[model samples]
Target chain A: MKTNKTSRAAQAFEKSLAARPTGRYVLRLFVAGATARSRQAVLRVRQLCEAELKDNCTLEVIDIYQQPNLARDNQIVATPTLIKEFPRPVRRFIGNLANITGLFVELDLGAKGKIAV
Target chain B: MKNNRPKSTSPVVHLPKCPTGIQGLDEITGGGLPRGRPTLVCGGAGCGKTLLAVEFLVRGAVQFGEPGVFMAFEETEAELKANVASLGFDLAGLVQRKKIVIDYVHIERSEVQESGEYDLEGLFVRLNHAIDSTGAKRVVLDTLEALFASLPNEAILRAELRRLFRWLKDKGVTAVITAERGRDQLTRHGLEEYVSDCVILLEHRVYDQIATRNLRVVKYRGALHGTNEFPFLIGDEGISVLPITSLGLNHKISSERIATGIPRLDAMLGGRGFFRGSSILLTGTPGTGKTIVAANFAQAACRRGERTLFFSFEESPNQIIRNMHSIGLRLEPLVKRGLLRFHAARPSLYGLEMHLATMFKEIVTFQPDVVVMDPITSLMDAGTASECRAMVTRLVDYLKAGQVTSLFTSLTQGGHALQQSEASMSSLMDAWLLLQDYEGNGERNRVLYVLKARGMAHSNQIREFLISDHGIDVVDAYIGASGVLTGSARAAQAALEKAAVLASQQEAAQLKREVERKRAALERQISGLRSDYETEAMELRRIAEQVGTRTFVLGTERAASGILRQADAKVAVGTRGKPGHGRRN
Candidate 1:
């Protein structure tokens, strides 16, 4: 449950260092329904995460339409959803996965899905 | 609309009912088309669909004694009746006479829906009742677009429509069905697909920013129709198609060439005359005397003690007569004598078919020996290409069959006078005449040319015709210093050419004067040298005796005349040029 909060916080960071092996903590988000409003939200989230995480963050995005059943196990409800999978406990966020400022305050930073501070 | 599949036993053959003979319309439709056959009249906005329907019913009663039924899907009966009051249709009178039955159906199709196997029995019952009551031989469906949204499932409605058409055919009546046209195709939502016995499309297109109503007949199941698009007009007489193509029909041969009250025009047609009962086309640019020519035709017809019907699409009869009077057509007496009938209407008043029908009926009723429509292009708004063509062809054929002489005046585009009128309409007439504004001498002059006259020995000469107080009369072929004179351009051209020729001649004269002046100076110098040489010789002889020397050559003498005698003068002045060179040595 703490990992969920950390992943949420991680989403606020516009860029992640998760791609790097040394500081790698890869976070992936999957969304359904690439509608105008949902796409707008994704754009905001992507911007905020990149701006906050700086050089040590990595984020990968995949649409649910590309793989549907994966979303069911993830318990996705609303469209424009975001999932923080990989590196410990997975976390999911429903609604507009936007609000970079509030999201960065709750996401994790390590393999244990906790803030590195 | 070819209802019969190969297996079907007998296709119901419905004889096209003639819409009430409206002057120009009955001529185009070849006797009003099959009664209740649902001839679709379609066009874009303001293409005169409603007016055409009204005209057909009104004229049916007035002219043909055939009562009519008009079902309105677009407007109220009162509204349509009011709209066409100015067209001289007298719809209210017809209704009162029980000659016309009008049912204005205002139900919105969008709100009405038939979920199951609902039949249009109510509409048919109402229509049949109206038809039976009025004894209408002609039926008009104002528009089909509004009915579509009112009835759900177009496929079913289409089937119902098919049944309705079959019913009309079984009843043996002629029908004029109006359809709203989509922006892209001929009819909205392909209503044409279902009703296809004869499709007349009215087109209002902006070419060079001028909106013209053109009627085209896309398909005619059983009859030969005019294939070219014809122009139509709407006015007090309703829609009038202008194409008077005289196809293969026996025309009354009148050897008498009634002079176009204008001597200029009559002379242009021929010194003897135009074929007595032939159709004439007066075509020219605006203000180039097209109306004047039409008036000439009218006056000539009236003068021969023959009745003439003049249909003016753009101007009122009074205005036409007034204006023509100024240019020189005296028609007030003709109107009083009932020898001339002048009808004016806007081209947007009715669809092309209706306009033509009204014209034909009017012509037939008047029993006019001659007919004229001024600026026929104004009527092009009534229908699309195919309808106008069929209607015009029918009109000309009808006229020819009746042996009634006809003439149409077409307003031509600038510089393309002959082309706009003669080329397109020549095939439809026995004689095609062109009125043009030719530029010469910095002025525009009206020149007339006869392009083609079938079955007549017509003059190939372009004649000079002028309009004065009396009427139109041909003077002679204007043989000026330049080409021809017609209106401002041809007159100006002649002036310019004459000026150019004069300028060239002046230049040559100036050159000749300069050469003569130079030659005179040379002659004066030679004469002066001869006198100077004599004086010098006298002095030289006296000097040589004093000097006692052998004769010296003029090269060393260095006298004033020596320059004159330097070459040719040396031989000539040596005492009659003694031995030429030997004497000189």
Candidate 2:
């Protein structure tokens, strides 16, 4: 009876681990309008996600002028703000997202120290 | 093109105002801040900008019955409540009662990083929610400059800050936005040029190592305001800004007289005393009984059932009470009865502005009929001479406007600059009493003289100010050959005058007796001569009678013999005798 209980507990732990998504990213970008900075931020974030995150990431770009409620709900005090929503410990960065190297380092998906758990 | 013309000729409309409910502030502001408009209150760090803003909101809620919302960007709600608790503002209670709300908008710079352009719609939503929750009529953004330091986007923050102010105006809420004072502009980001309606600048400056907080109305779009810098104080109560220039010389003048507690001194002031609302100055040298005189005035005011506030800079309250005990002024009883209040502090404890502000606050709270500042000269120790003068002038003006009798004691150093500084505020005084130490005949005496009393006839003579175990005594000025005499010299001179008068009286009596003796002698001689003449006449008459009788008898015997010859001889001798007698007579 004890062997049977231990085997079932191990099987449940393996099943929970298999259900977790691997190397997947979820993001939300907030912008004021289609200004130069906002456009550049959208383009840079899209390029980063396609190149680095590929099909594993889902990105939602919100224009504050059109969707001010969503922006306000998230406390978006500045425009072109990006929020990492998935893969535990959500993070936020406020910029045009043009500095890809600094962005990768801040996103924690660099060559080393990528989020493992 | 159509020329726009008015349909009717109506009077010009003016901007509405909301009263701040602050002492002297509303007067200087002509009413208060422009209603339904944004007012920028910018000041340096710890210069009372936040206090002023919070006070604006709290007063609106409490005094005006208008609800308010305080969206703090710097301090938390609990911190603000604790901070204003000392000011007697129960913000938590107001919040619970739904009369006001304090929403602290905390922005953690480390938790969030700026990526691109965004607006402060979150702050607006939260502020709007608070205002709606209480239907607030007033709103305060305390230390809005904290956002510039917290947030990374300056251009967007500036734009949003402008929009926020405009939005508050659109909401028809009288808003107060506090900002940190900038180097050259009224605000760090030049918020003054954007605010436009009104701009108030507060400064905490250290002059001569003493810090004083001053407030000035930099710009009021369409209102007339006092442009001078006014001193403010943040004490147990909230901010109290003294609008020194708001009060003109239009205060009501009282003709009622109040005693100086010294009967003789009152007599010197034309059988009355200081005017009920007059400003009296007592200037003296060190240890010349200036404090004693001020204490006497306070005692007199309290004895008359009027409240009195005594501000002692050189001595503590206990020291004053104990020292005044020797002079028989029982201030402790009046203090117990709540008629007399003693606020003693060192002159160096605060700047002159702070001292004035504290005095003003106490006066308002105590509502005293009389205020006595013992040794106002100590105020010069806290500030420059000119600054002290300005502070004193404002104090006098405030007291005069309230029709509260005020007494100021000053110490003169007996030199040119000291004299100039001593009489610095004499011109503002309605009555000036000068005390001096008269050193004569190897002793020093306290002498008091009324230097000036406007609109009333006061004694110009200096009196001997005697403070004994009984009370203050003002003896009559003794004028001798050596100018004015006081102390033992006066008594000695008075005794000499009495002796001289007595000696002159004795001399006049002696001369009168000699003249009476000479007159009696001349009268006795005349009487003796008259008596002798009378006796001689009587004897002559008697001899003539006897001779006549004898002659008659002899004539009768001889006339018979030779009648004819005798008759002829007798007629001739009688005629000759009669002619000689008539000629001799």
Candidate 3:
């Protein structure tokens, strides 16, 4: 029953993303220090924004080591976390973005068809 | 022997501790949790682990002049504030005053899709930021076990948790890490393995359908702490652990004495009554007036202008007041005057620990000079014998330490077991008064005697305990060859003695009258004899006169015959002398 509800909500979100393809996307990626994992997460999120939203997306990379207050104010609990801030329902994606397909589906970017890893 | 050898050679250096400022927790932990180190607090569901951690932070922030940071993983800041608000902790106010900072770590497993290896650097960063912002000396990571559920990879999670604890230690801030208890291990996620400097276990156990919360210091490295499980209560103020067993017998004793309300009962207790600040045990059988004795004690304390608190387990406050009124114990007036306070509750309302905690709270708030627990045996029924005895010991110790005289009424069953059952508790009391029913003459009568009174000369003789409209009257019980008598038997013996005395007095009065009559008869006999003698003498005198006159007349005719009959005048005078000499003979 939980999977069914999520699938229906995902379908609705996909339709809305398709309807407003030109709508601006605001994203924030929080990382800790200059670690390899943090660097990979930041690169992957920037790549997704440049490839998918092109000129309409604004991506901000924040290192919690430098601006630790942002981490406290934003309620960040895990490194390599990506937050879709501008969307009506702000969503958080935690951990390294290795599974590009799952990330696309989580971010509701599947309405633009499957993207190449 | 190896462990003891080192201690004998060198003095042990005490570990620096942070005081929790909690009622008894600090004492149990020998001070608070180890300073500047992470202490693992593990417990099962609804065991108050979260509350204990939160209170550590709140108390540190408000009381110790130390700022704190509360990082809640299970609850948000709003929820945490609202939850602690009921305990009279103004979390929002503390946060606004810059004394505390609350950072809520929201973790939703469904929202987070773990795709690759991730670290908990985010939590570390947030905690570090909160500490730096408020210069917090204390930090609480409430239930870090949520990370096990939020993050999928256990290997990375364990590694990160280990690092987090080490980092918290390096920061030099006292931290409390809460975790869920496991089936066999101390914590479900092996959190205790990481935070091993100190570990506290909280348990919520139900015994005989009553639940009691207990806290135990499972392990503390380089520090001594109470090893026994201490019962704790979450009251209006917060969690208060009862470190009762650890209390020493070193309370300051008061030499003052307080009356027991009944003057005769006081007279039996060395003319002054129970020692002030002493624990008095009043044990009796059913319907032997245990509550009456306790009520009398409370009234006496109140009359002396000392505050008295009455804890009734078997009856309501109003019911006790009404019943005492029948015996002329005016408790309502004392209650109205605020000198007496009554706290009434059912014995089965809660666990023994809760009841004890509530009593402690009442005693602290009322600050009474004397406390009376009516029928404490009923409260004893709420727990095992050992638990009840331990609770009573703690209560007695607490009252004595504060110089508050305490009176505990225990209801015992009929027969010899009364002394046997009270043997454990009676040792703790400074004075023990035994009230029992003497079944004789087809009636049961109440009798009281001072079984023991330490440091004072108390009467060993039993007194007939009488309850009348004018209050308790302690009269001397009849102890004779027929045995101890009370009630109607005592009255009858007194009447019999009075009757014997009256009979003996009447017999003495009758003998006095007889002696008076005998004296009167003797006097009458003597007077009659005297009169007879007088008459005889007068007749003799008249005959002599007649003889003289006849002799004189005959002498005229025949003077010689009269003279011969009467003789010469000198001869007659000589005859008179001869008659006088004859009468003298």
The C-alpha lDDT values of all candidates are 0.66, 0.81, 0.86
Candidate 1 overall lDDT versus native: 0.66
Q: Quick one: how many clashes does candidate 1 have? A: 135
Residues B168-249 of candidate 3: C-alpha lDDT, one tens digit per residue: 8899999888889998898997665456689999999988877888899999988888999988888888999888766789
Per-residue lDDT, model 2, residue B73, is 78
DockQ, all candidates in order: 0.00, 0.23, 0.54
Candidate 3, position B349, lDDT: 92
Candidate order (lDDT): 3, 2, 1
Off by over 4 Å in 1: A1-117, B1-257, B263-270, B381-390, B416-421, B477-585
Q: In model 3, state the lDDT of residue B405.
A: 92
Encode model 2's per-residue lDDT on B1-585: one tens digit a residue.
111335467644566889998777887888899899988888888899888988888889889999998878789889999988988988889888999888776656775665444567557766777787689999998878778888877788778888988899899999888888788878888864476588888999998789888889988887878888888888776888776566687889889999998889999999898899999999888898888888988998998999999998988899999999988888899999999999988889988867887787789999999999988888888988888888888888889989999999988876456457666689889898888888889999988888889988988787888878998887876886688888888888889989999999999999998888888898899899999999999999999999998767655645543354455655665454444434433
TM-score of chain A of each: 0.55, 0.71, 0.75
Quote the lDDT for B508 in model 1: 100
TM-score of candidate 3 relative to the true fold: 0.81
What is residue B86's positional error in candidate 1, in angstroms?
A: 17
Using TM-score as the measure, name the better of candidate 1 and candidate 2. Answer: 2
**How do these models rank on TM-score, best leading?**
3, 2, 1
Runs of candidate 3 with Cα error greater than 4 angstroms are A1-28, A42-60, A72-75, A83-93, A104-117, B1-13, B245-247, B497-585
